[model samples]
Every structure is written in C-alpha cells, then in structure tokens.
Target: MTDNRTDPPFVADEGPMLHSWLDWQRETLAVKCARLSQDQLRLRSAEPSTMSLLGLVRHMTDVERYWFRNVLTGENTPGIYWTDRHPDGEFDLVDTASAEEAFARWQAEIANARELSSGLPLDLVGKGLRGGEEVSLRWILIHMTNEYARHNGHADLIRERIDGATGE
Candidate 1:
C-alpha cells in the first residue's frame, strides 16, 4: 500500500503534537488495509479470534463515534457494528461485511471527531462521561492515540499474513 501517513511532529505544542500522533496512528491502520481485496480484508487473525483489517476499521468507526459524539459532545449515538446482544459484532460479523461501507463510515466519523474537538481546550472536560468519570479533551486524545496504536499493531500482523506486506 502507498503510505500516506504524516509523520508526527517532533517539536510542537501539546495540542498539535497529540493530534499529529493520533492522526498518524489512524493513517497507519488505513495503510495496512490499503489495496486489499474484500476477502483479504476480512481474513481472520487466528482460530477463535475474529480480528481482521476490516474489523479494525469497523471497530475504530465505533470508537471515534463513541468518544467524539457520544462522550465528547454528549450525543446519544449507537454502535454501527455492535450491540448489547452482540458485543463483538464488529469483528465477529465481518464474514459478509462491506469494506467500502465500513471505510466510508470510519472516515466520516473521523471527520466528525475532528470538527467536534477542533479548537477545544485540552483541559476542557467533555459533556459526557466515560465510566461515570469526567474526561478531558487531552485525555481523550491520548486514549485515542493509544487505542489506534494498539489496533494498528494487530492490523500489521493481519496484513502481513494476508500478503506478506509489512512496514511502519
């Protein structure tokens, strides 16, 4: 895949630095999934594990919506790939999922997240609560960076297994 990730800045203010890293992590996952076939995107990582490139995309879509819309702005939105009855639906129900649709939703959520958080102070607490505790914009940015980094690691392995492709 042609990598389009913007390297995180080495010297910058806290907000830009955090956002750059988060954006970098986001692009990392996209790079891993790029140029793959539908079946290839849904290839499972291993037995008993439903993790796949497409699953990661679906999962991140929900993650962005949860943090930015539901938690950040107090919007009561529901999961796109999961529910109480199927907690792992994002990964488990990917056998026939549409890669195109998943990517579109994921990108849209990312755009919405950017708009919601733009120019908001890092120390400003969100309107919603996570685990019944107030969370700051700074914390959300850090948490999201960590979340994407962890998942991109999985994407790395899955992509390699699918086509022997590997990179940062």
Candidate 2:
C-alpha cells in the first residue's frame, strides 16, 4: 500500500472502466521512463544484468500480448518475448534499443490488447492452460490487472534506482 488510504475496487458498471485501471498500471510503469534521457533509460539496473526500464517496457508489452490474446483467448500467435534461441531475451533488451523505440512498441502492444479485449463479454468463457481448465472473462481481466500491478511495482523500483523518481 502506498498510502494509508486504500481506495475501493472499481464498480462493475462498465468494462472499459475496469480495463482503464489495467491500462493505468501500464501507463504508470511507463511514467518512470517518460522523462529520462536515452542513456539513462538504457543503463542497466546492475552490471551484467540487462534489466533496464527499456527492457521492462518491452517485457510488459510482450506480457500484454501473452496474457490477453495468446493464453487467455488462445490466439496461439507467436509471442514477442518467447523465442528458442533466447528464452530470456526480454530481460536483456538493454543498450542498442532506444527509449523512443521502446515506448513505440509498448504503445502498439497496449493498442493490440485494447482491441482484443474490447469485444469480450463479462462472463465469456476462455480455456486456460492450467490443466486445460476453463476460466471466466472477468477472471482473466483481474489476472491481467494483477500481472500489471506486480510488474509496475518492479518498474517503480527500477525507476527509483534510475534517477530517484518514484510513484505508481
């Protein structure tokens, strides 16, 4: 909890409102990267570790695709981050990738997610990969939201280390 005041959960009035929250987390993750210099954004969080904010942005972009359309909806589209040669390449996108390119990719990923999730009904059924089980559309929304929340925290930490900036 960032503060003693905890807000109530989003009302179930509309789907867009709830999804906006999910988008908010991703936007907040980008917030930490917004004002940094390209050099700063490219700098690794630690030596020999390529976990820069840029990398996180790309990873989250891949994550948005993985969860929304691929896994939950079973699109089976090739994943951006999962490749045979470098399974963990998502974490190693440090230098040689500019902040502008990273932001552009993130924006595109979020756009794709928004489009994919737009038509899903609240109670829509999706077959999950866990033992080939089925899950609710609402559940996937919450799961995606939670996934964004967790990674956003990591983004916050990485941002603070980058230049002492913090929040959301």
Candidate 3:
C-alpha cells in the first residue's frame, strides 16, 4: 500500500500539533488498508483473535462517535456497532460486513468529530465524565492519537501478514 501520510509540522502550537499527529495517524491506517480486497481486510490475525483491518476501521468509527459526539458534545447517542448483547461485534462479525459501508461510516465519524470539535478550545472540559472525573478536550485529543497509534501498529502487522506489505 502507498503511504501517503505527510509529515506533521516540526513547529506548531499545541492544538494544531496534536490535530496534525492525529490526522497523520488516521491517514496511516487508511494507507495500511489501501488496495486490499475485502477478504484480505477481513482476514483475522490468528486463531482466537478477532483483529482485522476492517474491524479496526469499524472499531475506530465507534470510538470516534463515542468520544466526540456522545461524550464531548453531550449527545445522547448509542454506539455505532457494539451493544450489550453484541459486544465485540465490530471485530467478530465480519464475514458479511461491507468494507465500503464500514469505510463510509468511519469517514463520516471523522468528519462529524472534526465539526463537533472545531470551535472548542483544548482546555474546555467535556460534557461527559470518565471514571466520575471530568475530561478535557485536550485529553481526548491526546488519547485519540494514542489510540490510533496503538491500533495502527496492529494494523501494520495485520497488513503485512495479509500481503507482505510493510512501511510507515
């Protein structure tokens, strides 16, 4: 896959720098999934593990919606894929899942997250609480970057296993 991720800026204010790194991580995941067939994407990493590129996309979509829309913006929305009865559905149910739909949902979540966060400052506290503690927009941003970074590492191994493709 072609890694189209551009380097984040060397010098920038805190907010822009964080967003830049997050964006780069997002693009890196896309690059990892690029040019792959649905079967390739849905291929599990190994027995007893449900990790897959398509599953990661779906999981991230839910993560974005949970944090940005539900938590940060105080929207009372349910999760995109998982539920009490079908937890881990994003990763477990992939035999018939549509990659196109998954990607579309992921992209939409990203756009909505960007729009919902546009005017908020880093210091602004989120409307939702984590572990009974208030969370800041800055923390969410950093947490999300870390989330993507860790998942992208898994994506790297899965992609390489799928087609022997490897890179940044």
Candidate 4:
C-alpha cells in the first residue's frame, strides 16, 4: 500500500487537530483499499456478511453526503447508492458495483464536505438535527472520525482476508 497518511499533530488548536485526525482516518481507509482489483475490492468478509472494501467505500460516500450535505448544509440530498426501498444497497447490491464510481463518489463527497465546512466555526450548529437535537460542527467532525475509524477496522480485516496484507 502506498500509505501517505501523516500522523496527526500532538499540539494544535482544536479545529486543525480534529480535522487532522479525521483526514488521517480517511486516508487510512484509502490505504486499506489500495492496489486491489475490482473483484478483490468487492470480496465479502464472510458468509451472510455484506461488508466489503467496495461497500465500505460506497457506504462512506452516502455517509459523507448524509452528514455534510443533508445535516450540515440541509441540502436534502439523496443517497448515491441507496434509497428508501434499498437502504443497504450500498453494501448489499455490490455484486456489480463499480469500484471506480464508488471511489470517485466517495472522494468527491469528502472534498465537497470539506469545502462546505471550511472556515466554519466548530461551535456552529448545523441546519439539521440528530436524535432531535441540533448538532454542532464539532460533533459532526468527531462523529465522522469515529465512523471512519470503525469502518476502517472492518476494511483492515477484509483487506487482510483478501491477500494477507495488513497494517495501520
């Protein structure tokens, strides 16, 4: 893997610190998916489990849109790979999903989300709610960091199972 992740700074202001950690988490996922074929990317972890590197990429695409576009900006944007009828399509319907498209969308969503929240105060409350409570940019950043961290673990396991490749 062409790992380009930088260790987050140990001393920094709150905003840059959080963004660095989130970016590190994002890059970790990319590294996990690197240098794998489409079929390899789509390989599920185990029986009855829909999780895969490709699915995680697709799922994170929607997740970025959901948190940044919908919740942060109140755009009401729909899922790129899912709908009301197929909520898990991002994971479950990846038998023929395009790794190219999924990665592109995921990167685009990440870029757009970063742009949308750029220079915004961490204390700024979003236009949407979570659990009937308004969420701040700080909360979203932390949540996204945690979200990616969790799924990146799954990605690590799946990648390991794919070709015995493993690392942070």
Please report the candidate that would top lDDT against the real structure.
1
Superposed model 2: Cα runs more than 4 Å off: 1-14, 47-49, 127-131
Clashing pairs in 1: none
Using TM-score as the measure, name the better of candidate 1 and candidate 2.
1
Relative to the true structure, candidate 4 reaches a TM of: 0.98
- Tens-place lDDT digits, model 2, residues 1-168: 132223335775657667767766766676677777888776677676677777778788788777777666787766675477877677764557666876887788788878877878868776445357677767777877788788777777777887777774
Off by over 4 Å in 3: none
User: What is the descending lDDT order?
Assistant: 1, 4, 3, 2
CA error at residue 25 for candidate 3, angstroms: 0.6
**Candidate 3 lDDT trough over 10 residues, lowest sum:** 70-79
The predicted structure with the larger lDDT, 1 or 3, is 1
TM-score order, best first, reads 1, 4, 3, 2
TM-scores for all predictions: 0.98, 0.81, 0.97, 0.98
Give the candidate number with the greatest TM-score.
Answer: 1
Q: What is the lDDT of residue 132 in candidate 1?
A: 99
Q: In model 4, how large is the Cα lDDT of residue 160? A: 91
Model 4: per-residue lDDT, tens digit, 26-140? 9999999999999999999998999999999999999999999988888888898898999899999999999999999899999999999989999999998877889899999
- Tell me the deviation in Å of residue 128 in model 1: 0.6
Please identify which of the two predictions, 2 or 3, would achieve the higher lDDT against the true structure.
Answer: 3
Colliding residue pairs in candidate 2 = none
Residue-level lDDT for 57 in candidate 3: 98
> On a 0 to 1 TM-score scale, where does candidate 3 land against the true structure?
0.97
C-alpha lDDT of candidate 4 relative to the true structure: 0.94
